[model samples]
Target: MSKQPQPAARAHNGETRPSYSERLWVPVWWWPIAVAVTMLLAAEIHMGAPGIRAWLPYLVLLPLPIWVLLWLSRLRVEVTTDADDGRELRIGRAHLPVEVISRAAVVPATAKSAALGRQLDPAAYVQHRPWVKPMIVVVLDDADDPTPYWLISTRHPDRVLAALGLGTASEPEHDKT
Candidate 1:
């Protein structure tokens, strides 16, 4: 079969950047809710405060929520090629070489619970996000590596599979024997 061209993004310099990157950001709706909740908490702390204590709480506590939300949304998933042209999948701080990826399957939203609960192996590497439903399960072939596979949470599973060159292996885990 002929090899298909990989999806790429244009770099800032207008160069063709070959990589797939996705950030697991918190939903936009959560921002206002977070700010509202933080304000309520700060208001409660401000009650009956003497002088600067009232306004001090607002100044200090307000940024706390924003900082926390930004921090929580920092998880990123990236697939990039190395100097040898081998692909690597980086999920958050963890990195997995595509060469060792024996099999990969997209776990649908319906089976996410079971995959994370019952079917999950204790030795497996899992990057889960409650905001994201669908996931990609990558089975490893490295004997030296004790980890069996990686359960990664991604909003675009199809694109992730395509980036990893596992587009044809997008079958669900339960479908296989």
Candidate 2:
């Protein structure tokens, strides 16, 4: 039996008014890496001192349990964009009200050069997942709260931004030089 709990809205929540919802997990790229690491550990254990090599299988498989737990826990995240009833953007446990959201934009590719150099306020909330690419930048209008924005990694950044009434990302100008 899997100890990791399932996403909400499937169980006792009973609320089914979400306009948009998506579940995101670690990207496909991580799978091979995980396997490679496991193999590497096994290889190392097999080549270790005779006494230590006796525990080869156990040592190599050790990270498996930890990997599974992490894969279930931190590597998976649910993104819920509820407009009709909740009027909020939900990513895992944290949520942002649609009303408080000022604006949203797809993080430009050039942002890599800047290394997250755009609109980084001191009191912002960031929910970053290493596996996800093309994160969305959401600005907040709530003056009461100190948080300036939310930088979240999502597979469907456009959809999430659109759920916040941000529409689509503007195409950047290309240089022809």
Candidate 3:
């Protein structure tokens, strides 16, 4: 039996550059489920005791975090090329269009954390896996909305930049002064 061939890199204007997009999903651990279950159980136990019935409203709010997590997990980016124009880009339920993209590039790991205006949270946080950096950030070409940047966690930052034609040789020369 012959093995199936994998999809080849997509070509744009005779140049082979695959479209790239990264989706943000919840870590594939049982933690979300465990948290949901623990909250349910704790709420049940708290409500079971006498005189705690008055606090039922608070107990009912225990599931809010789980709902939030599920909602966030559904957030994803869909990157593709426009067959007619042949411009590669990504779109999502909540993202600006690729046509609105002004710049894209791989930022060194240290700069990535700082550029996002994010602080390392010691308690609980999502730290990009070391192997995933240097991560790619795309600055969108919008003025009214102003801040339109995407700090995507990806292993193939170069491929992503190439696909969008944002990592051109001309860009680096300007930064080397």
For candidate 3, give the lDDT: 0.55
In terms of lDDT, the poorest run of 10 residues in model 1 is 1-10
Q: On residues 1-177, what C-alpha lDDT tens digit does candidate 1 reach at each position?
A: 111333443454543344799999999999999999999999999999989887998999899889998999988888876545677787776777788989898888999999999999999989898999989999999988889989999999889989898884533468555
Q: In model 3, state the lDDT of residue 104.
A: 74
Error of 3 at 36 (Å): 6.5
For each of the candidates, give the backbone clash count: 0, 0, 0
- For model 2, residues 19-82, the per-residue Cα lDDT tens digits are 5666566656666777777777776767745786667676668679557746544532343443
Q: After TM-score superposition, what is the CA distance of residue 49 in candidate 2 from its true location, in Å?
A: 6.4
Off by over 4 Å in 1: 1-18, 168-177
In model 3, where is the ten-residue run with the lowest total lDDT?
A: 119-128
Q: Which candidate model has the greater TM-score, 1 or 2?
A: 1
Residue clash pairs of candidate 1: none
Quickly count the clashes in candidate 3: 0
**Candidate 3 residue lDDT tens string, 92-149:** 3333445677777776777866754564233211224443456666766666554546
Off by more than 4 A, model 3 = 1-18, 30-66, 94-102, 118-134, 140-156, 167-177
